[model samples]
Target: MKKAYISLLLVLVLFSCTKTNKKVDITIPKLTNNPSWDVVCTNRKPLLSFYISRGGIGKRTYIVNLDTEPEFNSPNFIEYKNIEELDKFIVQKRVEKPLVDKIRYYFRAKAIDSEGNESKWGYTRFSLDTDYNKNFMNLTRAKVQNVRVSTGENPKNLIDYDDPGQVSFWQAAPPGPIKPWAIFDLGKPTIISRIWMLANINRDNGWLVDFVWEKSLDGKNFEEIIDAKILNNDTFRNVIDITPVSARYLRLKINHFRGVAPHLNCVIFYTPGKPKVPTPPRGRYVLLVGDQMNGGTFTQLAPYIETLDLDLKTLTVPHYEISLDMLNSILII
Candidate 1:
């Protein structure tokens, strides 16, 4: 009887140990955007998406939390519990709350299965600032003090004006074995956010093909910021938004193009700051509107323009400063 009792006790102890050692198999959620190193710098809410491994056929629950601190100890921290039909949710556009400006907020999310198994939390952080959203000025017009090119006539024409309406063009004279290149001096070390190019009006096929945009601080040493190649020329403007870089000199090296000579109409660079108010128009009666990408609105207003005998001028923001020629026109906000 004593031996049998001891055997039963041993069996119970082994079962208890095994049960305690068993691990819960839960699928942890993955945060797609707003990685740890990247600080989202806009007031506009960013899309949040998540992925789950071994997504079962059944429904799942997602728990998202946000806090101002990394430890997530704030009493004002927000939590969202959503039951999703799919095992994964992606690119969610809305957020429950608005983040305060200048505050760095931490984000975390976890997943729970139908079986009540919970997953570990994934984490990220983001911040908000109006400085990131403000319309920046064209530095090529305001900052570029000098222009130089390896093989071109009147390189100053590239920086002479930011207007696409200009007739002057700096052309890469052909028959020379050397590739065409142009350098722009920004006067000082300035942070460049975007590069805008106007298609050459001289030739229909004179669009830029393969080129590299490089930057230099001292004007002696340089590094490439953009390598532009593929193009879909739907408009007269080609704008390239790059990661903000600080440099005193910007160089454009033209590798190849469609026309006999590489013709450059205008090249403008923009940096983050308040954009200058456009020069007001004088003595002309034209209705001005901001850039309309698809021209659907313009098509609808064609009848109105014809009836009013009004000249229509469409100006792209920051690229073309806002100025209206008044026929006592009402500027649409």
Candidate 2:
């Protein structure tokens, strides 16, 4: 037993001496957002940051791994090797499959020096969760119940989504004041986190260049939240992040416009948390119009047909153009 113990001690002493002689002892890279990162859930493409020790010689090669499974053994596990940079990887674009919503994701990284010395893996876990911010001004939900403008042509067009191209916009009527304001009424009080505005880039001075955001619980009383004057005319999209506030009415007051009229193409109000996604209908029910067998008009019977949890599809094509593929997709004739 003493001989065996001495032999083990000799091996340990040699190993310790060899390890100490090495110039670079590569330790695990420190992950900046370990455990959990909220940005991964909110950003479609998130940038990962990390720190590597200073002792590694020559160019460092980073290996990054991402997987849906915690074990990182899934078929979809993605590996990126030979990366020269220590930070900034756009994980979304490189993913093999679309990241499913509300699914936990695993990330790990390691570094190897030119001399083949390697570091321990640094790991993190995050999820593209249900806490995504959503635009509440969607036309489908009719969230912007009503809109009243101080002076503009078709203020309702902002929420109607009727513009075929970029040609349509809400502009102050000619001969009216260059300053125009609009108030939006959400049917119920809603918590708003941010606002997005896309202006017409064609008109240099017609955009919502200078405006103020105001909110009110009652439509009558309003308080200003932001007074913005955009100096960069090159960009069309303007986004403003605000502390989340609940209000029933939101207002946008234009202070100055240099062109013929104050103009804006689109506006979006964002609120935290994703809305529940409705299940897609399994198969479509084709309604062969002009046939006497289907007696009711489309407008009157469309709602009733959807109650069966089936999608309604109207055959707008000529009888000769009706193909087999179309018929196969429909559940009912």
Candidate 3:
């Protein structure tokens, strides 16, 4: 009886050791590097990448979350499960929210082991670097040569949409059955890939409007490149993609709800390459003199004052109000 009791005690001890060895505790994963992120304004989407020092288990996955705010605790956060799905996300790059021109976005990632153990969150942020002023067809580079209707309130406000302090907008009033339209000359032929339009939010329900964008190599003959109606639920900006067309002239015809004319805050054009710098004319030139009230005497005396070479074509206007057609003809200006 004593020998049998001792043998039972030994068996219980061995079983307890076996159970302890089978149970393994999991360790949290460590972040190896910061996330890889990029934003493309033309695509209107941002790309994100995640990495860890090592997944807790051999077969592991990840969870990615995106938010406008830095905090990741919101219930409305956009989530993606599994590493394979997260990696495949680049192919179908789409932003849940319409991206503002220069707004910042926040992203975070967490790793999950095969045993369902999750690591702490890793964070990253990115913003779109879209500067409309740098665009090839901006007001600094191009001009609104002619329009079907005259300016409604401020004459210069048609193209001066970049000013943040003023409530400057372009509007056409009365006697128009068709939509109001405007024509812009880019000063010279440029390769344009996209067009961005920001509507006047205060007037005429800017978010609800249809636009027809047409491009022309010569001002007379125009070809419609985009005709789709953009319906914005919450966004203020509308981006239109077009085939890379070498055009010097572009026209935008606005169709608004009811008979109310469309009000535009800003319009911008984007090209792939850098802005074209005018080459110096290689011959004798003449300096056409204009009114000296607005620095006209200074304009006439500029070439002589600077002792410019006779071969160089130098025209200096104090007001810099040269017409787009004249600017295009004289490339050296």
Candidate 4:
């Protein structure tokens, strides 16, 4: 009985020693590739590749986090079983929230082993360059050299509307028999794609006005590009996208104001290529005359006027009557 009791004690001691000798894997995986100074486009999806120091250690998955702030261990961290899964995650993020220009993206990655032990977070960063503005940079800025108004409280106030600053505004007087219109000379012939206007009706007064944008290769013969009605509740910045048109002069005609004069803050014209030819007003011309002058008359005449386009004002008078024989002889009328 004493020998049996001694043998049982030895067996217990050997079992305790064997359990204590077992090894636990607490090794943290090291990052092999840490990217720096990587530039990516705002419109494109960037692929991030990383390497782990020990791939054979039963690494089951990776935990990836991308955010403007560095919170690696947060609940929002994305998990991936492999590199292909990580790529899919990037594609999904891009579809949800597109990366914006001039912004930095932070990326953190960690490896999780089969034993559920997570490695230390590895970090990298990438930035979006301003190269996305290449399309805008190629276009030229159209300058407003001259401003003419049919009727206004202060004609000189029209100059303030050329800049985009909203501090000052140009106010036109109440429309009379002749509609209040503001004509602008862009100083040169340009191929324009877009026009932007920042305007608002006078405060405390709700009013609406039909704003017409007319473009002219010559100062005299104008063609309408945009005919839009603007209300007091409309946005301050109004953008008009039009097919590219070559023009030297642009006109903003206001169809009779409702309550008071409409306030205009800025007018911007975007054109492609460099300015080579200067467009100046020589005189007005009579392209076509109907029984009465109205908006419908101009819209109907746009197709004909576009065909017989001219760079210089050929007419010396506001109204001119030419016979069929004389019209055929004139190159531009």
Q: What is the TM-score of each candidate against the true structure?
A: 0.41, 0.41, 0.38, 0.38
Off by over 4 Å in 4: 1-138, 159-165, 201-208, 226-233, 256-258, 273-333
Model 4 earns a TM-score of 0.38
Error of 1 at 231 (Å): 6.6
Ranking by TM-score: 2, 1, 3, 4
lDDT of 1 by residue, 278-317 (tens): 4444434344443432112334454455467455433233
lDDT of each: 0.64, 0.63, 0.55, 0.55
Worst 10 residues of 1 by lDDT: 324-333
Question: 180-206, model 2: which lDDT tens digit per residue?
Answer: 788999988998877767666543568
Candidate 2 lDDT (Cα, whole model)? 0.63
Clashing pairs in 2: none
* CA deviation > 4 Å runs, candidate 1: 1-142, 162-165, 227-236, 276-333
Clashing pairs in 4: none
> What digit string (tens of lDDT, one per residue) describes model 3 on residues 1-333?
999999999999999889655643343332223323323333335444444425454555777777667785655457777764234222122355545456556666666777776677765555555663243342222344544343354434455533451256666664365556777777788877777666554333544355577788788898877533344323445666666777888877665532355566666666764333334345655544344322255334656734764445655532223445445656645
Angstrom error of the Cα, residue 16, model 4: value is 81
